[model samples]
Target: MADKPMLDDTEDVALDFGAEDELDRQRRFRHPVAVFFHLAFRVASILVYLLCGWFVDSFITSFVLIVILLSMDFWTVKNISGRLLVGLRWWNYVDEDGKSNWVYESRKGKLKGLTTAAESRIFWLSLVVCQVIWLVFFFGTLFTLKFKWFMVVIVGSLLNGANLYGYIRCKMGSRKKMTGVATNFLGAQVWRSMLATATASAAGKE
Candidate 1:
C-alpha cells in the first residue's frame, strides 16, 4: 500500500512537469509577428525623416514638423496593435486545448502576451518622444550658423547608435532596459519635454 501511494504521487509530479515544459516551449516559440512590426516601424521612421528633410521647403517650424512626424509615427503603431488587433481579435492567449489563459501566466516571465490599453499608450508616447528629440536636434543643426556638417553627422550617428543599442537590449535583455546611451548623448531637450508631457497626459486621463 505504501509503495502504491508513492508511485501515484511520482506519476502526478511527472505529469505536472510535462505540462510546464509544454508552456515553456510555447513561450520560447513566441510568434515573430511582433518583431516584424518593430523592425518595420524603425525602418519607416528613418526613411520618412530623411525624405522630410530633403523636401518640404515650407515647413520652417522644426517644432511643428517634429510634432507631426512623431505623433503620426507613435500613434499609428499604438493604434495598429492596441486598437486594431485587440478589437479585431480581442487578443487572447490559449492553451494547447484552446482554452483561454491570462495575459501573463506567471509574473516571472517576460510579461508577454497581448498589449493592454495602458501599455499601448506608453509605447506610443515613448517612441514619439524619442523621435521628436532626434528630429529637433537634426533641425536645430540644420538651422545653425557656421554650417558645421560635422555636428549634424555626430548627432545623427549618436541617434543611430542609441537606436541600435535599444534594439539589441530589447531583443537580448528585458523589455524595460534603458540601453539608449546614444540618445542621451545626442538627443535634444524636446525629447525630455515631450516625455514629461506625455506622462502627464496619460496620468491625467487615467
Candidate 2:
C-alpha cells in the first residue's frame, strides 16, 4: 500500500513526458519562421563582428556595427526564438527595492512542446559551441590585452547567457509543474479513500 503512491507518482511523470499523438506533433513546430530568423540572426551577429575587424580597418565603425548586431541577436533570441522553440520567455525588471530581477514565463500546453527534440538539441548545441569559441577568443584577447576584441566578447557572452538561461528555466518550470500535478493527484486519491471508508462505516451502523 505504501508503494502505491510511488507507483502513481511514477505513472504521472511518465504521462507528463509522454509522446503525444503523432498527428498532433506533426505539421508544426510552433513557429518555423521565427526559428529560421533566430538562427539566421545569430550567425549573422558573429560573422558581422568577425568581419568588421577583418575587412574594415576603421575600428570605431566596426565596433559600432558589431554592437548593433549583438543587440539584435539578443532581442530576437530572447523575445522570439526562445518562445517559439520552447514556449518559454524571460525579461528583466526593476522593483521598488531598486534591484534588478529576471522574470521567466512558460506555458503548459501540448502546443508548448518544442518542435522536435532534435531541433532543440541541435539549436542548444550550436549555442554552446558558439559560446565556447567566443570564450576561447575572450581568453586569447585577455592574455594579449586586446581591449578592442574584449569588448566584442563581452557582448557576445551576455547574449549567449540570456538565451541559455531562458531555455533552462523553461525546462525546469515544466518539470516543476508536472511534479506538482502528480503530487496533487496522489493527495486526492488518499482523501477519496478516507471519505469512502467513513461513509461505509456510517451505513453499517444504520
RMSD list, candidates in order: 19.1, 18.6
List the candidates' TM-scores in order.
0.29, 0.64
C-alpha lDDT of all candidate models, in order: 0.46, 0.75
Q: After superposition, how far is residue 155 of candidate 1 from its true place, in Å?
A: 18
Candidate 1 residue pairs in backbone clash: none
Per-candidate clashes come to 0, 0
Error of 1 at 197 (Å): 38
> Candidate 2: where are CA atoms >4 Å away?
1-30, 95-101, 173-206
Which stretches of candidate 1 lie above 4 Å from their native place?
A: 1-31, 47-72, 83-129, 132-206
lDDT agreement of model 2 with the native: 0.75
Worst 10 residues of 1 by lDDT: 82-91
The local lDDT score (0 to 100) that residue 161 gets in candidate 2 is 74
